[model samples]
Target: MLSKRLVSCLDVRDGKLAKSVRFVDTKDIGDPIEKARTYYEEGLDELVFYDITASSEGRDILIDVVERVASQIFIPFSVGGGIRSVEDATRLRLAGAEKVNVNTAAVQNPDLITACADAIGSQSTVLSMDVRRAEPCDAVPSGFEIVIHGGRTPMQLDAIEWAKRGEALGAGELVVNSIDADGTKEGYDVELTRRIAEAVGIPVIASGGAGRPEHLYEVLTEGRADAALVASMLHYGEYTVGELKQYLDARGVKMRMRF
Candidate 1:
C-alpha cells in the first residue's frame, strides 16, 4: 500500500500563522516560516500554507510569504487562497510551491481547475473544499455543503458531487476540510471524508479536527483518506510530525519514517 502522508497546515492571516475554530475566532499563533522549517525538519511528508483571509479580503495570496516558506521546507508544499487564474497558479509555481490549491476561485469558476491543470500539470493542481455538515435536502442530498471565502459563505453545493466534479475537471487531488470539525481537536469527520473519497478516484486529503495520532490513523483507514491535514495539533506544539508518524507506523499505517 502507498504510505499515507502527514501534512502540516499553516493557516496564515496577514502573514502571521493563525488557528481558528470552525472557521471563526481566529488568533495568531506563530511565525509561519519558522513553523514550516520546524515541521520539515521533523520529517513531515508535506506542508500546506493557506492565506486564510486573502479570498475574503479580496486580495491575492502573499507570494512573499510563500516564497519564504518554500525556501525553508524541502517537502511537497501546496499553497491556496485567493488564487483566481492560471497566471496566479503559475506565479505560485514560480514562487516555489510544488502544488497550487484552488478553493474559492474553483467554486466560482470550475473551469479554473481545468485551466490551472492545463497550465501546470494536473498532479500539481489541488482542489480544496471547505465543507460543513448540513440538513439533508434535495440540493445537498449528501448532507454536506461547500463553504467558500474562508468559510464566510456557503455555496449550497453538495460536497460529494463537487468532489467528483473536481476530479473530472482535472484536479489531481482533493483536500476535504470539514468546517464543523475544524480546530476542535476531537477528530476528523470520517463519514464525510469516506463519502468523498469513495465518490472520487483521486487522492483525498482529510482536513480538520485532528487531535491526536489515533485520529490520523482512523481517518487514514476508516475514512479511506490518502493523507491527513493537521493544524492545531502541530501549530500549538501538542505533537510533532515525527511523533505522529511514529504512532501511526506502530499501528501498521504505512508512513515514511525517518528513524
Candidate 2:
C-alpha cells in the first residue's frame, strides 16, 4: 500500500500564517515562508498554503508569498484562494506552486477546473472544499454543504455530489475541509471524510480537526483518506512531523520515516 501522507496546512492572511476555530476567531501566528521552510525541513510529506482572505476580499492569491515559500520548501506544496481562471493557475505554477487549489472560483465557474486541468494537467489541479454539516434536504441528502469564500458563504451544493463532479471535471485531488471540525483539534470528521473519499477516485486529503498522531491514523485508515492535512496539532508545537510519523508508524500505519 502507498504510505499515508501527513500534510501541514498554513492558512495565510495578510502574508502571515494564521489559525481559526470553526473558520472564525482567526489569530495570526507567524510568517508563512518561515513556517513553510520549517515544516519542509522537519520531513513533512507536503505543505498547503491558502490565502485565507484573498477570495473574500476579491483579490488574487499572494503570489509573491507563494513564490517565497515555494523557493524554500523542497517538498511539494499547493497554493489556493482567489484563483479564478486558468491564467491564475498558470501564474501560481510559474511562481513555483506544485499544485493550485480552487474553491470559490470553481464553484462560481466550474469550467475553470477543466480549463486549469487542460492547461496544466489534472495532477496539478486540486479542489479545496470547505464543507459544513447542514440539514438534510431532498437536494442535499448528504447533509454536508459546500461553503466558499473562506467559509463565510454557503453555496447550497452537496458535498458528495461536488466531490464526484470535481473528479469528473479533472480535479486531481480533493481537500475535504470540515468547517465545523476545523481548528477544534478533536479529530477529523470521519463520516464526512469517508463519504467524500469513497465518492471520488482521486486522492482525498482530510483537513481540519487533527489533534494528534492517533487522530491522523484514524483519518487515514478508518476514515479512508489518502492523507491528513494537519494544522493545530503541528502548528502549536504539540508534535513534529517526525514525531507524528514515529507514532503512526509504530501503530501500524505506513508513513515515510525521516532519517
- Candidate number with greatest lDDT: 1
Local accuracy of candidate 2 as per-residue lDDT tens digits, 1-259: 6888989988898778898888888899888888778778888999998877744342343777877877677788999877888998998898899999999989999999999999988999999999999999977799999988788998889999999999999999999999988888889999999999988899999999988678888898889999999987877888888899888899988888853
Q: Rate residue 32 of model 1 by lDDT.
A: 88
Instruction: Give the Å shift of residue 70 in candidate 1.
Output: 2.5
What ranges in model 2 sit over 4 Å off?
Answer: 55-61
Q: Write the per-residue lDDT of candidate 1 for residues 88-140, one digit (tens) a residue.
A: 89998999999999999899999999999999999999999999989989989
Superposed model 1: Cα runs more than 4 Å off: 55-61
